[model samples]
Target: MGLHGEELTFGVEEEFFLVDASGQLVPRGPELVFGTEERGGELQQELIRSQVETATDVCRTAEEVLGHLTRMRADLAASAAERGLRLLPSGTPLLPKSSHEITQKERYREMADRFGAIARSSATCGCHVHVEVADRETAVRVSNHTRAWLPVLLALTANSPFSGGAVTGYRSWRHVLWSRWPSAGPPPMFVSLEHYENSVAAMLRSGAMMDRAMLYWDVRLSDNQPTLEFRICDVAATPEEATLAAVLIRGLVNVALRDVADARTPVIVPDEVLRANLWRAARDGLNGSCLHPESGELVPVWAVLDELMAGLRDALRTTGDLEFAEGMLARLRSTGGGGDRQLAAYRTRNRVTDVVDELCV
Candidate 1:
């Protein structure tokens, strides 16, 4: 916890697609970018050779997150440019080939072997936010409290409206593709930390997951760090948007922590309902209604967002992120989300190339 009794410390991890001069997916981009001996550990290869990931260090404020993400994105863009490639921060590849493009790593190979088709089809990119927690138990509590709101965050970050050079008719086709994983979606509420561990252990024994790291829940306790990870968002189109997401996630976690401290019971929506809400968010982004987590009633997406902001008002202020969050929210509503922006770009020239060009720039 920071000085205000809030765990505002957080970090962001973003995955990007590497494209060629014409904005087509480049199969060897990861090898060219991250294969060198001088490459830093912060940049890594994802499941696909054309995909690269960069993670920011632990950030104490939204400004720090923005700085780290800006530097990392600039470095990655420059590196890709040097290799005659362009780095595109998007959820799905605009022109991926039909075949799988796996990175040549042992773990990645093992994943391809185990998951088969699902692994092969995973050229998707996402943004993950990790917020520090006191311990495993507190992390579990925060995860439970935070699960209901994950869909709202997902809608805000929807950037993958097209896939394989055609409109998917969904704002976040990446979420649809990612939901194919057996371990994906909202996790069940656990009675305790031991219960959570046992549940994961059961999944491992069932051969449903390769390891603890394969637990792809929308929100989960980090396997390698003392933080609760939020995996519900697509990679934003810009560093500023990513930083906005990190700020909102930190605020949400802080609000959850305060609720736990006050002995407030976590909302326990049915798994089916939660999944439906997630689907709604993925399909519509902020253009349609969503299931209100607290009221169990369908409401406009903007209404749900306003409710979320209202709930986190104090926490956002306490963490010194209120003004920035509000400003970003207003801008998002005004200009529309990343998906809308992509659609607008496509609508302008009726060319997917233009969308890719816009995203890459």
Candidate 2:
């Protein structure tokens, strides 16, 4: 909560893999612990020592996100160098490995204890951005309204073109891999926060979930904060991409909040329709059409994003970031994404090794 209760803020969590100098993802988690934890700036262990997550404190503006992410990246890069570790971003490994190891943290241990094989199979990395709402009610409202747009966001930020050491044939295989969990995918629409809580309580009573956090919906209201969290994106390979995605998320939340306040009708696609759109986005990226959440008609990826920006321009302007949003949109068009970059690098170097080098570099 900031002044006027009208503050639009952003917070992000990114997961990365610890790779060796030879550009291979090491399965040894505990061995990389010192290099990562010793850096000391919001660096935290993830489900395994081979994985690490770094987060930024709540920031009220896009520029602040840029500053924090830049500093965090620098810190992690330095820390990884000190201990013979490297950080790389991809949804999963293409090469495949033995055993899905969970980090030794109590929380994670509980996850494995509760979810069995689902928890063990969770080796994907992602980026979750938090956008502040006025209250829990608005958090639920925004989460519902934003569901139709989640797939678009996922598509735009698609960066996991490669897993282990091969092309995954999808722009975002992480989404599919994560969907295998018991409590994952797009959340059911709820009329109110109480309805959501009741559903969650029922899950707890039945032992279906360890707690609310396990919901793992692509979009959901955070239990401990007055914000809606968008967890559908892959960990961006570049700071510019991360910041751009954060700005777009902030703008989307603003658009939803305004619609909620004005009692405006939101074009919500059914859960099934939304799921179809997600599958399309994962398969096609910006190269094809996605099923519209409500209309069920195929829509171009860039068209959907452009329309979203148009609807939220006033909100972006209010945040004094209209230019920032436009700049990012242009970059997205010009640079494509990690997927495009990886494809290009592969063509030039003729190997997945070169693609990973380009991504990690």
Candidate 3:
């Protein structure tokens, strides 16, 4: 019953793929970070040898978000390049040369063993944005309201449209692949935090999950942190795009909090409808259309996002993030999502390497 409204804050986590000079996926993992540090490199707390995660300090204003994100991305790119690697933003980096090339971390190894090919196939990159709430109640409320907006986020961020040496059909094959795990998918709507916790507890007791974090819902409460995490986005093709995504996610949370506080009950579509919307986002990416939350009628995905932005303009102004949000949407509309670029690159070059080059550069 913890639905008390609260002011919002922000955090960001960006997962990047390591690429060689030729723009091929490199299994450098966190070993790259370690190797760099051993050689007087300057990154820390990375997730794997080939992948590094950057987390921003909690931010209050959108300016602070932009400032911190820009600095972090530049630093990470510089450090990674010094070690003969580049960071590519994508969901999965065309699968490794072999599954054995997975990250060397024990946890990663165990994940591969437990999840089998699904884990091995998860050489994906993503950007996860966290918005802070005053308490668990507000967090739950934001989470509930937030799910309906996720497919649009996915459509905006669509970047991974291919896998291995073949076209994967769906714009974000990684979303489908990532959902292969038993616990992966949208979270069911629960009436209270207690109900949510009980569901997680039942999964844990049944030996289906390791902990709360592994629930792997499109959006969920961070068990170890005081925020709701949205993981529906693909890794962006550029640091600027990633920053834009972080800004939009932060803005959405503030708007959701305001709506809840003002007695505007959140409108979430049925789970099945949401699933269909997500599939449409993956299949069509930016070129695809989605169902409107209220009318259940098909609307151009970008048009729906435009309406959402217009609706949230007041909240954006109140949070002083309106310009940043608008600017980001402009870029998304012009450049399209990651999957759009990948498709374009594939059209011209007829090679996945070309797509990787487009992704990194």
Q: How do the candidates rank by lDDT, highest first?
A: 1, 2, 3
Which stretches of model 2 miss by more than 4 angstroms?
1-5, 27-41, 98-100
**What lDDT tens digits, residue by residue, belong to model 3 across residues 1-361?**
1124334677777777777887666666566555543311124433334566667788777677667766766666676788787877777766446222666657667766777776665666677888776577667777887788888888888878877768889888878877777777777776888988888899879756665657888888887778888898887777677777776787788777767777677786898998888888878887689887778888898888888788777767766778877887777778777788888888896877777776673
Candidate 1 off by > 4 Å: 1-7, 35-41, 96-99
Evaluated at residue 253, the lDDT of candidate 1 is: 85
lDDT of 2 by residue, 2-116 (tens): 2244768778888877677666666555555444543233666776556777888888888888888878777776667777766677666434453357777798999888777
In order, the Cα lDDT scores of the candidates are 0.86, 0.76, 0.74
Task: Write down the RMSD of candidate 2 (Cα, Å).
Answer: 2.5
What's every prediction's RMSD, in angstroms?
A: 1.9, 2.5, 3.3
User: What's the TM for model 1?
Assistant: 0.96
Measured by C-alpha RMSD in angstroms, how accurate is candidate 3?
3.3
Which residue pairs in candidate 2 collide?
Answer: 47-103, 93-164, 94-163, 94-164, 269-293
Query: For model 1, how does the per-residue alpha-carbon lDDT over 145-205 read when each residue is reduced to its tens digit?
Result: 8889988899999999999888888889999999999888888998899999999999999
Query: What is the TM-score of each predicted model, taking all chains together?
Result: 0.96, 0.92, 0.90
Question: For residue 255, what is the lDDT in candidate 3?
Answer: 72
Task: Please report the candidate that would top TM-score against the real structure.
Answer: 1
